[model samples]
Target: MNPTRRQVLGGTAAVVGGSLAGCLGDPGAAGGDSEGEGVFTSFFTLADFTRHVVGDVAEVQNPIPPGEMGHQYEVGSQAQVDAARSAAFVYLDIPGFQNWALDSAENLRSNHEGVTVTDALANVELREIGSGHEHGDDNHEEDHTEEHEEDTHDGGDFDPHYWTDPVRSATSVRTIGEALAEADPDNAETYRSNTDAYVEELETLDETFESELSERSIDTVVVAGHDSYQYLAARYGFEVHSPVGVSPNAEPGSAEISETIDIVDDNGIDVVLYDTFSSPRLAETIVNESNAEEAVAISSAEGTKQQWLDDGWGYVEQMKELNLPAFKAALKAE
Candidate 1:
């Protein structure tokens, strides 16, 4: 009943200019050393992947603080300063997704000679965020007004949810390994080895998803918040329907909510999945109005929750424990 299939995920920058430019200067000047100046990632997910690749060879730091959305969190210039002191900054360099990161990466490449900037999104064929009523009336299209400033970062255009797809993430694991090996050539072997092991796990996860979702009673999964599962849907052959589009800030209108409820009723779906990061009111309403019996929580893993950290639930755990069961229930997969 499924119709589909699923690639590699590069870009690393080398900075060779002035002496680390003030705070990000040399060891003595910048108050940093090889051990202290480790790899700094843009957010939790990247940090998790980078940590796996580095394997204690180099410390991995996520500049985004806890309880903050990685896409829209405002850390001002502190993240740049901290990252500049590191051997590398790992972040997706796609424009509009993380404009500040793009700017900061450029700064590191241009001014910080000791730092390496790697764009995890390099060579990735990003999907555009599309609009329409998935199972609703064909004549109704959601408004694309003066919002969606973060298509990926929190806005629209190319969907920046590739990390959600384990197949693509396996490729990203290698990309990070390559970047780290290049940054610290002495441990290139270790980085490569770690990357290989981690990638194997990711590929296995991809297989789990494929095998689990291949034969499903339903073809679509409806979310009550902003859609973050395009990569997952595309990779696994299911479509994601949501009232919200790219921007997390945008609120769903009454019409959108009514249609999403209609979708749940039309599909005979019993479970409604909601982004853990977004408010659950919309999902609760959808469940109340439709035949859906329960609302489920599925995190994107872009940020972390205290409980998630307490349980040591990284990206893989989040996907398996949270998303996997939710999809299995909603899609009625065998």
Candidate 2:
């Protein structure tokens, strides 16, 4: 909001832009950056979803550099200017996740009149942190949308990872479709058609997860890694237990580690699942210290891995190829 502060920030971005570009690979050619430039997003999954909805209508750019995790990436000054200059800036609105992005979204709304700003989570129902962590048989409580509408960036009451569920992802897709159409009204029809097709794919993915994991032998999502799978757990009626909490780099207390190990041994959980980006040391410790056969890495789909980028793995690919298998192993699904 302050002119002096903004100029300082933008100047910083211009300085970092060149050097970072060298390490950032080809923005348009690799991973989720479907085209070199057009509609830019906050991170990988959002970029992928934007690409599907935009189709050939717009080139979706990813701001997070190659191999850097979205949460950890420090957004440069140029990224904000780039977003403001683009047709639209689509971003995740979760609090504490990427506050810079949230600020940029607000600036676009207040300062930049022409650029469209879309919050991918706008339509999706949010879950309270640890909403379905209990063993009780119940769906999550309603989202506190109204209460937190004014300060959506405030980091309480809501979990940040809503895209982990395909059903919620459908809502996100439609929101993006609407934003793109708003930004480029002439191609509304094309964006609508593209969005519908993508939503259908998301629906299919939801069905697959439901049917396969509905009657899994294990009803709990036991992980030694990150707890980003709360949505997946809530959707399919599974309790969640992760001693490391929700962060990949979190260090669990000894008691927490002991409890996680106990869950593995007590439930006879075969696979100890870790967030793909996390160090395997903790998971390895859990596996070696408990009855778990091995520690497996499952993606949160927050950022694109280098290998996944090469393989062209997108949201659905991560869900099907990586997540489902890790879940099957952890849940002992037949």
Candidate 3:
């Protein structure tokens, strides 16, 4: 179950953080007075976004290990304690996605007097698991939607994968930028300017997706794993069919698998999409069972540290390189 927004807000007292020293010109410098203060993010995606906005003005810290899935990550007591002591702690307020951070919000505030805690999703609009336009067989969609609705964490009703949509992710960039500016007033202009530049890039990315997907004939996609691409689908006017629901932790039963296979066969889905963090077995099964010719990896932006480092793929790059191509081939776009 997911936590309610009320529960999450109950933890907030007031928002307010500090100077570390490090070279302001070098973005890669370690945390210190010369560099700036430490800004802790709950996941790599947020950290990546923050880095883009803050540059070398503040040192961004993403405690979640590279390659580890952020949704399933459980912060240790020591780590939690240490994070609370940072200059600013940025976390997704989506309850089910980052339950530990939501639970620790109040504690993080109480224990650390000067630390600022910002909910990156505070101003972003979130989607519910099955709230958007429906696709696929009516019966199967209903069953899966019901299952997702029941899978709550403090009673919240939103999908936390907004980063999958570059346009939607711009909202987060703004939220994070404002938080950073507030935390370090000295670099406020830089943060705002950087955010504007990044948002422009995101807007361009959104236009590309709109133009490309609009020209595609196929309107449905089958993901063998969880249905994390709902935001992308909704934004671009496509329907996503997945065996599992929104949360990756929720396992699909045999009946669900069979239904997904049916969707693949009926739609002539050429490629089954799977996230980098998911097991390929389910995608392989669907491909083998149906006429689907292949399977491809679509990053959910929850990639491991080593993968991101090795690939050097940023959020926009992942969508442009991996997701866009996969969607084009799967949909048989011109």
Candidate 4:
């Protein structure tokens, strides 16, 4: 069963910055723009939501640049201090995925008194990456170690890609809307109305995905990137197998790579799925080495918001385009 948005937000209760609880009343008490320069966050998607809600009231700065993968971003000392100094509020993922963002938030809050930090996942539930049920004991330790390395390397706490799932993403949008309204009370009505409309659109997208992919024949997918896809896997029925761990930078061991090839071959996988942030090289290698004929790039939409915007692909549209084919291929067996 899909968890409620409230359940997802509940997960962020563990986030640091005890200050967030009190500031929820008036985020603007620190500093927010009546006109411009309302910084949103590390992930471009959050900015997308902020734009939808805040509308013309505030312009958001999505600090992370294009092609700069958030999972591996390292904030410099001066950069961290500067981001804190300039922005009124800093929105970030609290789970291990954006630990660097969280670390930056902590530094910013401690240094400057007014900047409010909001966790995107604070109200969104998390999907476990490569759940143990599929990988078993042999891969459990390795997965854990890889998750740690990814977390340390990027400054994330848990899995930061919670927005991959539409349900959680809608919740995030609402949260941002509420925060923006609080930040700038004058435009509260507009923010609230925008969020309501966007949330409705999100609901439509979720319905489309559930209807489209729910009856598909394919059940298992093999991926090389290992940048997390738990939300998508959980939303649909597919079991995702990856050679690397949470951090896409982590290389898969030769043995694991071989094992993934065997799994793909043994299962007669129709295609190898790769995401935007991942190197398709390993997937290509596996397909070539195993003599598999099919391969495709499925957007996990991680670190690819600009591409989506540029391509005129919104969440529902992109997911449908990228995922429907795989489901059609996989479900054909049913």
For lDDT, the strongest prediction is 1
Candidate 1 lDDT over residue span 101-134, tens digit each: 7667667766775566666654444665684212
By the TM-score metric, which is better: model 3 or model 4? 3
lDDT of 1 at 20: 18
Per-prediction tally of clashes = 6, 2, 23, 19
Model 3 RMSD vs true structure: 7.0
Model 3, position 149: C-alpha lDDT score: 27
Per-residue lDDT tens digits for candidate 4, residues 1-334, read 1121111222322122222222233334444322123554665566666667766655566666666556656655654654464434545533355555656665654555445455454456554343433332122222223223244443232455666678888987877766645544566688789999999988887787777777765577787776566666677666778888677668888999999889887887867777755567888898898856666776665455556668876555656787656545644433
**Candidate 2, run of 10 with poorest lDDT:** 13-22
- Look at candidate 4 and tell me the lDDT of residue 144: 28
Q: Per-residue alpha-carbon lDDT of model 2 for 1-334, expressed as tens digits?
A: 2231111112111000111111122333313311123677899888999889877655788888666667646798998888876656777655567777867766765676445566676546667675543221012112222233355332345666778889888887887776666435456688889999999999999999888887677777667776787888888888779997665556799999999889888887888888777788888998899888988888888888778889988989999999988897789886
- Per-model TM-score, in order, reads 0.83, 0.81, 0.83, 0.76
Question: Where does candidate 4 have its weakest 10-residue lDDT segment?
Answer: 1-10
Residue-level lDDT for 250 in candidate 4: 80
Candidate 4 deviant stretches above 4 angstroms: 1-36, 75-82, 85-87, 93-96, 128-157, 305-308, 314-317, 324-334
Q: Is candidate 2 or candidate 3 better by TM-score?
A: 3
Worst 10 residues of 1 by lDDT: 1-10
